[model samples]
Target: MQTTNNTVLITGGSTGIGLAIAEVLIKAGNEVIICGRRESKLLEAKQKFPQLHTRVCDVAQKSAREELYQWATSEFPHINMLFNNAGIQKEIDFLTGASGLYDEESEIETNLVATIHLSALFIPHFLQQQKECAVANVTSGLAFIPLKIVPVYCATKAGLHSFSISLRSQLAKTNVRVFEIAPPIVKTELHREAQARKQSQRGIAAPAVAEATIRALKNNHYETIIGEANVLKGASRIAPKFFHNLLNKVATG
Candidate 1:
């Protein structure tokens, strides 16, 4: 993907890795549009980066997704990139008899459903464009190795990883390059909240993930993994038991 002369839209761009990626790409000279559920966060992001274009959209809701799709097409017809980066992670103790009635839907909705819907919504518009376009899905290292505590979150990321694979193959003849970014646990508010909920283990910084992602984009690396995430993905193949047990310790501790 060219570093400049393109308009990019990122979901959950108000904070954490999304914001970091937005900052990185925008600084590289692309017109960036970031959407979040909170108006205040969008306002805050606008204040922090005055060049940022903000939109208020709760992707968990179908109507909001439709509105966002329509608005993006009408407002930024030249958008060549869609970053399915917005996601929610929650720690649920399945052992405590957390039943099916529990509301763990946010993780599935925001992380998986939104990605599918957004991809479907934007692909046609991208295909209509004359320029080379791309879709970057922000998956997790956990997609390869599931953490039992956050079963739903891990499951969603895994599903997303699978979706991106099929989407890429299906669009192989198109100009849009499907990219998957598998991040290691990053030091961000997402981890802070997981820690507060007694869910996830400690992780690396968001800037590191963002920097690695930008480099991968520049080099056209389709499936990109950073730091320990690469180790985890490999360990899940060769040392599944060891990796699973190690992560279980962090959740149970």
Candidate 2:
């Protein structure tokens, strides 16, 4: 995929990894449009980078997803790249049963379902474009190895990883390219809940993930595993039980 001169739409672009990506893409000369749930956050992002086209839409809702797609494609008809980067992470203790699952945002809806729906909406448009187009799904290293505390978040990413693989195979012969970007725990607001619980929030910077993602796009790497995520992916395949225990141990410790 050509890195420059492409129109891109990134979901959850108001902050964190999404904003970092928008920054990189804009600097690289791509027209970037970003959407998020909060209008104030979008305004802040717009103030920081005046070039970004900002919209407020929650990707967790099916109607919002459809509206975003229609608006993006209609307003920016040249948009060829879609980055499903909007996501939320929550720590749910199953010991509490159904009470832990009653959140305003569903991890399955925002992280997995939104990606599937947006990809389905844009793939046909991308196929009809004369140039190469791409869809990059921002999954997590947790997708490979389950993190016990955030069960739902990990499950959604795992589902997304599987979907990206299938989507890539399906689009292999077409003009659309499917990419999966898996980053290890990054220092982003996604860890707000964990931070509130006094958990360590140390990890790679969001820019590292953003830079890795651009490199993956430029090099056409279908699956780009960033940082310690590579270890999780390798260990999951090589020594599943040991690493699984090691991972949860570190988290609980």
Candidate 3:
């Protein structure tokens, strides 16, 4: 798909991968609208990039997602791209059984449910567009290989990965192009705040992932697994047990 001149809406666009994508897309001359739950964060992003359109809607709630779709479509009828980028990551120690009930809900709601529901809400609108349209779901390397500490987060991504495959098949005959961009660990507030300082710093830059995504979208790659994520995916397919042990060891150590 052509990158420039398309009106795109990105969820959780205030920071991290979402914000990075918004910045790059804006630079490419695309009309970018970003939605998040935090008004302050949205304004901060807007301050950084005056051209970015901001919306405060938590996609985790069904009502909020619906409202966002209605508002965005009405405000920007030409919007033809949806980036399901909103997500949360937390380290849950299931062994200790200390994780709260709300933790599971937050991860599932934001990561998996919101992605599916938002995509459903936007697909028909995209199909009505006079030009080519696309939907890109931002999953993670954890989808292929689970990090035991963040079980729910990994599971949610894995679910998104599976859903993307089914979604692409269903929309194969339609005008919408479905893409799944699974990123490796990136140095962002989301990752940094959830892990130890050293491990967090070891991540790839969010902008690097954004650049790779742009290149993949330009090349029409349906499954854009970036950087070390590709290694994880390969390892998962080749030696699941070994990788699982290795990853868990590193995570715990």
Clashes per model (N, Cα, C within 3 A)? 1, 0, 0
Q: Residue by residue across 41-130, what tens digits does model 2's lDDT show?
A: 999999999999999999999999899989998999989999999999888888988775757878888998999999999999998899
Q: Model 2, stretches more than 4 Å misplaced?
A: 197-200
Tens digit per residue, CA lDDT, model 3, 149-247: 789899999999999999999999988999999998898877854456466656888899899889978999999998878889999999998998998
Which of the two, 2 or 3, has more TM-score?
Answer: 2
> After superposing candidate 3, which stretches have Cα over 4 Å from the reference?
96-98, 103-105
For each candidate in the order shown, give its overall lDDT on alpha carbons: 0.88, 0.92, 0.90
Residue 244, model 3: lDDT of 88
Judging by TM-score against the true structure, name the best candidate. Answer: 2
List residue ranges in candidate 1 displaced over 4 A. 96-105, 197-202
lDDT of 2 at 247: 91
